[model samples]
Target: MRTSAPAAVLFDMDGTLVDTEVLWWETAREVAAGLGHRLTDADAPEVVGRAVADTAAHLIGVTGATPPPSPPPPTTGPPRWRAPQPS
Candidate 1:
């Protein structure tokens, strides 16, 4: 039996193949430090598994910085990926 080609390939950049959570945590830590906030292990849960925007908001809120301005609605923009074509 032959298998069909995949229509799309998903990448689990969070941790399945590559553990990049540590890098995210480090970046959050760095940003917190810049804001005069000390990031602790307790922050890992909120920072590591979250989107960067969420983490930034968390940091800013905790640091007592003025809330960020609301952004325009999201756009579909360009296609992020294209499936491989049969050769």
Candidate 2:
């Protein structure tokens, strides 16, 4: 292990690395729309950079969504294809 002072560190607090912020915003907007709620620039504080569960809970509260309850019992056979395996 080399333990001199570190040469550098990297962080992406505001998406300079890959700029997925817009994708996150767009997806949140679409989901909000599906929940019969509308999201705008004003909603960013509650939606952007939030954990998925937190955002999901926020949407549920804002739109009175129950998020469809637990999933229905699994379908059998064909549509229930086996889980994928890595090569």
Candidate 3:
């Protein structure tokens, strides 16, 4: 028996394959610092696992960052992907 290719694949990156929670924490801290606020342990819960726009909005409300820019227009095509080849 053979299987067809999947139409899409999804991976949970934050705590599964890669430890990105620290990266997000540090990044939020850095951005808060740049905007004249120091992020604390209390702040981590709100910033973790949020979209960039949501994070930016939170920063604006807390640290006064300039409003986030509007997103760019969508492109006209299905996104391209490349499957890994067997080695």
Candidate 4:
């Protein structure tokens, strides 16, 4: 399998993989606002991976969404993966 190309690839991960502490979208909106530009709520999802020029263009095109206040970092605890005890 390692030597051959995958006929079908499957991606899998636990909920741990979903953990993210940063709010880059919020940061971008804040910076844009500080630069005298406004970003609305509807515009955030579209801004995720594009270049700065493209993002700015999208914002300009949509007239931007009202960016909400930054959310607090997601609270986390130690993973609960534990071995079962013998009865």
Candidate 5:
């Protein structure tokens, strides 16, 4: 079987490439609070940087419309993490 080569890279906004996964989860929790549903940090990382629809769908599956999808907060810090792909 032929394997496909990688074609892209992703970098963290924090520059350290540290798992901002927690940050996204925290933010999501805060946002979800407004809807009267409490989302735990464990549930947040799954939808970071996803489109509103995707986030909404995940939320629907998770808390059932507790957190309305919206634009995430602006990102800050140097670029972190990278994945190179062949062109």
Candidate 6:
């Protein structure tokens, strides 16, 4: 008889195998404070598991960064890539 390899492999990391949740929370708080927005425990749920870019965008909005320009009229071709705004 021959044995087959497993069909899938899952890795448990971060909060599952290691306790880095607090570290993440602290880092988020520091970043938010540096950006001039106070982060509270009440905001933890939303901040956790979010990408850095997403969080930065949120900070930009909260810190009164310039509003994005209105999109140009839609066209029929493939979408274009806009350069990321400076943080």
TM-score rank order = 1, 3, 2, 6, 5, 4
Candidate 5: residue 47 lDDT (0-100): 71
Candidate rank order under lDDT: 1, 3, 2, 6, 5, 4
RMSD of each: 5.2, 11.6, 6.4, 13.0, 11.9, 11.9
lDDT of 2: 0.75
Regions more than 4 Å wrong, model 5: 1-16, 41-52, 60-87
- Pick the winner on lDDT between candidates 2 and 4: 2
Better of 2 and 6 by TM-score: 2
Query: Candidate 1's residue-wise lDDT over 1-87, tens digit each?
Result: 999877777877769888998898988889889889898998788888886667877887777777668843443367676777888
Cα shift from native, residue 33, model 6 (Å): 1.2
Q: Residues 1-73, candidate 4, lDDT per residue (tens digit)?
A: 3584445544333224552223557766776776677777666666765555556556555555554365333
TM-score result, candidate 2: 0.58
Q: What C-alpha lDDT, on a 0 to 100 scale, does residue 27 get in candidate 1?
A: 84
Best by lDDT: 1
Model 3 bad stretches (over 4 Å): 1-12, 71-87
Report the C-alpha lDDT of model 5 over 1-87, residue by residue, as the tens digit. Answer: 899765655644552768665676666777677666787656655677664556666676766564445755434455564556456
After aligning candidate 1 to the native by TM-score, how far in Å is the CA of 80 from where it should be?
A: 3.9
Q: Give the per-residue lDDT digits (tens) of candidate 3, residues 19-87.
A: 898899899999899989998888777888876756677778888767747853443367565777655
**Which one wins on TM-score?**
1
The CA lDDT at 42 in model 4 is 66
TM per candidate = 0.66, 0.58, 0.64, 0.34, 0.40, 0.48
Error of 3 at 80 (Å): 6.2
lDDT tens digits, residue span 1-87, model 6 = 998666555544357777776777788778778767788867776667665555556656666655457533543356476445545
